[model samples]
Target: MVAKSVTIDFEFDWGSRIKSDYAITHVTEKLLQVFKKYNSKGTFFISTETLPNSEKYIKMIKNAGHEIASHGHNHTLDYDVKSKMDLYNQIEKSKKLLEDIMGEKVIGFRTPAFKRSRYTDEVLEELGFIYDSSTTKSKMRNRYKPMQYANSKKLIYVSISTIRDRFPSGIKWMNLFGTKLTGKKPYIIYAHPFDFLSIKDILKLYDKNKIPIHVLLFYTARIGSMLNTLANCIENSQTIKNIILQKNEK
Candidate 1:
């Protein structure tokens, strides 16, 4: 059977507005268990600002045979607003911090909210990054511009696949089935730890948060079954590094 590459990307970020009761550790543990059960691996894009506290979790992901990548210092949208040097420092510092913790070179990056400055690609190339998974082809989102950056010698921009709703959700049946039906090989799916969280956990923070009710349900309900379906649908699973490496050999 031909092995079709499927990349599962996860974003890890926390800020002041984040709920105190929502524990990343708890959410991460659940995701790890799910991936393990499916015999799948994922690339976790971690925010460097959450370091020290996230050290153990990062270690846990690494030891689990998964890949780690940079998600910037904080969940800042500064990539579009900050100065070029400031942006460089932000990317450089986060990459260094993550490398220090992982004890390995960090080669992948996904911008906060998929917002990339004009200098985003230049900075990534300068930092020796191999690939970026920040762009989305979906046209529904107004803030995100539609553009495709073909893979080159310096870096590859892996566009995030969108579902009917233009969001990458494991539970989105149409997103998975439609992609397969359309013969879109090497599918990439991006998710957040909170997607696997329980409704009870989310309700605790719902009072103060304005998160939509259906959005919460879409992620929390039948998530396990949805993930399992995804695992079985894809012929092979791979990290972004492996994908690029294979492409380079071709």
Candidate 2:
């Protein structure tokens, strides 16, 4: 049978440069819709620090048929936590907060900023996390690179790459790439609603009068194109076809 997997993690933090906004909210809801339309399931790892104290949004996510997991409480990078004790506190506390809100066992942990330290593994283990999706497989590191782990068990590392790696075009290059090329497993793709929107997503809302028209249009078109590509991948493929057929047989 074809295995399908999709995972999403939010890295919201207090000192992050971007501020949450309506555009971001809209993008997130739309993301849910797109997945639902295709009858796909995904795990969403959220930062307890950014979660609204109220349970309204959490309920909405559950009602929408998505799995909720914990990112962290303070969204502190594992390497920046200073000591093993601090790291343990951060992870354990975040898991407790998320579990209380979701009323379900949160068995996953993703490191903030994808920053790794020896403490990262220790903390995840202490918290009893069954999976970790915080490592980038690519040699190149940028703002948000995709990471993939060969093993798909407790602590599965998904590609965090934002965009496709740029390789010089070559003669033997007639191929469609991205997650499909990677494998049939539902790809773990993470992005703030802002990333899908644009670099100036928050800036435009804060100061609409000063924003340039061309820049806004560029981001809009980029997101539209990206969504289209994702839709195509979700709808068409032998792997997806197999998955659907297997479900029907069962």
Q: Highest lDDT among the candidates is held by which one? A: 1
Best by TM-score: 1
Taking all chains together, each candidate's TM-score versus the true structure is: 0.80, 0.68
Question: Whole-model lDDT, candidate 2?
Answer: 0.53
Cα displacement (Å) at residue 231, model 2: 2.0
Model 2 lDDT per residue over 1-250, tens place: 3354344555441223333434335567776677778876666667666657324555666678777776666755444445888778777877887788777888766667666565676667667776676765444446334442233444534333322443111101101244433432433444444444544553555374344566455445454355554554443222222333465598
Give candidate 1 misplaced runs (Cα > 4 Å): 1-23, 141-143, 148-153, 164-185, 208-235
lDDT agreement with native, every candidate: 0.65, 0.53
Candidate 1, residue 88: Cα displacement in angstroms equals: 1.3
Off by over 4 Å in 2: 11-15, 21-24, 76-81, 141-179, 183-186, 198-203, 206-221, 235-250
Question: Candidate 1, residues 91-138: lDDT per residue as tens digits?
Answer: 899999988887889999888867777778888888999888777676
Minimum summed lDDT over a 10-residue window in model 2 is located at 167-176
